[model samples]
Target: MPTDATAASTEEAATRVVAFFETLAPADVAALGRLYAVDARFKDPFNEVQGVPAIERIFGHMFEALDQPRFVVTGRVVQGPQCFLTWEFLFAFRNFDKGVTQTVRGASHLVFDDQGLVTLHRDYWDAAEELYEKLPLVGGLMRWLKKRANS
Candidate 1:
């Protein structure tokens, strides 16, 4: 059972994390130390890493690879020292669809330490439906595969 203070701490941590992601920029990658523990773990469909430095590198790569990549947190649920957040990632592909913006819907599960620093951050999203399906040649192949599978 969580006490009032525990709940409050979790809420505060969740709020800070959501704000950090929504306004994240290339410069903000260095500031991850403020919100994440020294040995925090982060995992998504394509990458999995531990420690602040590794996480920083992942986010740094994101900035280098995409154009105007940003997250819009749509909803949040905080419980004890954990939070679940639903979000949409918006970005323009530097190499693919030039000026067109793409949106990927996903969710993240965050676990915070007693001090309100994130200890674990795991993202959930379908690579085929949300990402690969948005590509040019790959998109057509994936759609055909989906249709074939259903039929």
Candidate 2:
């Protein structure tokens, strides 16, 4: 059982995380230190990094590769120092999809430190389905593979 204070802290943490991602930008990379611990570790399908600088680099690459990328947190579950968030990441490939928004549905598992800064962040998503399948050449191959697997 969690006390009222604990529940409030968890809610606040979840809200803060969602707000941070909602407006995340290349310039906001520096703010990672505020939301994450100095030794925070972040892992996703495309990146595995430790520390704020490395995490910032991964987000920086997002801006460089995509246009108008944004994250919308659809759901959040928090218990104690851990939180899980279901989200849709919207973006457009700069060279490929151009202005068309592509949505990647994913979830993030986060562990926070005593100070309420995230200590570990892991993102879960299907790379082939959510990302590679959106590409012109790879999309066909991925679809074929998925169809074959389903049969």
Candidate 3:
């Protein structure tokens, strides 16, 4: 069980992470160094990177690939130095979807250091269902497969 002080600290760190991701921008990529430790590790469905520079590059590529991509933290739970956050990542594909807004529901598990900087950040989401299933031709196949599996 976490003490009151430990819970408070975890909540504060979680809040900062939510705030940072909500306000993420190309210009703000460099500021990630402040939120993450120098040797921080980050992993997601499509990326596994360590260190601030690598993490920065991953976010930078997101801006390059999608238009107006942003993360909205919907819920949060804190435990000691660890936090879990549920979020919706919203974006519009510049090339394919055009102006259509795409939403990917996901969660993140974060571990923060004593100094409050994130040491490990891992995102949990379904690539096939959340992403690949949203594509054009692949979407139809993916839906069919899901239906068949369910039935």
Candidate 4:
């Protein structure tokens, strides 16, 4: 059973997390240091960054790739110390125009502190299918490979 305080804290943390991502345009990710605990652990398909310093580097790289990026979190379910968040990211490569928006749907398991700051954030998604294979040249190569392997 979850205490009311826990639920409130998580809800608040969720809001902050969502806001943090919404403002994120590669550059805004630096503010993540303020939201994440000093010893925060963040993971995704491409990299696993531990602590704020490493995390900042990862965000820097991501920002360099996508200048204007936004994350839309549609659903959040809380259970005790954990929150399951479903989000969709809208972004485009630097070379791509503003009208070209790619959406990546995924979920996160977030654990928050008493102060509603993120202590651990883990994301689950397949980059091959949701991202890499969606690119122009890379996507064509991947599709060809898949066709050859399947046939």
Candidate 5:
């Protein structure tokens, strides 16, 4: 059971994280230290890394590869020192369909430290359905594979 103070802290931490992600930009990557612990761990379908520097590199690559990439937090649940956030990642491929925005629905599980800094961040999303299937040459193949798998 969590006390009122613990619940409030959790909610506050989650709120800050949501705000950070929703307004994230290339310049904001430098400030990740304020939200994540020095040795925080971050993992997604395509990346598994620890430490703030490694996490920063991942976000840096995201900005370099996409145009207008942003996260819209749709829902959140906080319990004690952990929180879960559902979001949609919106962006346009810099080299591909630059005129159209693509959305990737995903969720992130975050565990906060005593100081409200994120200690563990794990993202859940289907890359094939949300990302690869939206690409150019790979999109067709991925769609075909999905059809075959479902048949």
Candidate 6:
């Protein structure tokens, strides 16, 4: 049952999510706190940060390290009540600075509020498989360790 509000909110949130990632490489506070709830809780491979301040810390590490790491949404799917944003991350970190570029594919699970602010956001992917394994000196070692441990 898609109500008018749900349809509009989802659409709006989707755009905002995209814009957030696109502009997020620079940590644009010019348009921050508007897309997420005041008590928003975010989690990724790194840390479980809550609220805007924690969000700032987690993202700060990224923007500072990633040589302009940006996310590009490949496709978006609106389920009965949720929107999953599939994205590809492009960046150049000393870890993966092979004198070229590196990209990692991932997805975000988002549940929006009536006002389109993200109430719950969860990211799904493997840091080791998608990122850590792509790093520099640590890349080979991490991959080998992961494989040995898994096997």
Question: Which of the numbered candidates is closest to the native, going by highest TM-score?
Answer: 1
Error at 123, model 3, angstroms: 0.3
Model 4 regions lying over 4 Å from their true place: 96-99, 145-151
The digit string of per-residue lDDT tens for model 2 on 1-151 reads 7667776786787789899999998889888888999999999998898999999999988888889999999999988788999999999888886899999999999988767889999999999999989999899999999999999
Candidate 3 residues lying further than 4 Å off, grouped into runs, are none
Question: What is the lDDT of every predicted structure here?
Answer: 0.96, 0.91, 0.93, 0.81, 0.95, 0.77
> To one decimal, what is the Cα RMSD in angstroms of model 3 from the true structure?
1.1
* Global Cα RMSD, each model: 0.7, 1.2, 1.1, 2.3, 0.8, 2.5
Q: For candidate 5, report its TM-score.
A: 0.97
Q: Give the residue spans of candidate 6 off by over 4 A.
A: 25-27, 95-99, 145-151
Candidate 6 residue lDDT tens string, 1-151: 8787787778878887888887674547434578788788788776777786667667677767777678889989875447898989888765445446778888888887777887677887788888778777778999899889999
The lDDT-based order of candidates, best leading, equals 1, 5, 3, 2, 4, 6
* Model 2 worst lDDT run, 10 consecutive residues: 1-10
Comparing 1 with 3 on lDDT, the higher-scoring candidate is 1
lDDT of 2 at 115: 76
1-151 per-residue lDDT for model 1 (tens digits): 8888988999999999999999999999999999999999999999999999999999999999999999999999988888999999999999978989999999999999999999999999999999989999999999999999999
User: Superposing every Cα of model 4 onto the true structure, what RMSD results?
Assistant: 2.3
Q: Give the higher-TM-score candidate: 4 or 5.
A: 5
Clashing pairs for model 4 are 26-63
Candidate 4 displacement at residue 92 in angstroms:
1.3
Put down candidate 4 lDDT per residue, 25-136, tens digits, no spaces: 6667678877888898999887887798888898787767785667888898987767889999888877745557888899999888777778888999878778878887
The Cα error of candidate 5 at residue 10, in Å, is 0.9
**Per-residue lDDT of 1-151 in model 5, one digit per residue for the tens?**
8778887998999999999999998999999999999999999999999999999999999999889999999999999899999999999988877769999999999999889999999999999999999988899999999999999
Show where candidate 2 strays beyond 4 Å.
1-3
For candidate 1, the clash count comes to: 0
Models sorted by TM-score, best on top: 1, 5, 2, 3, 4, 6
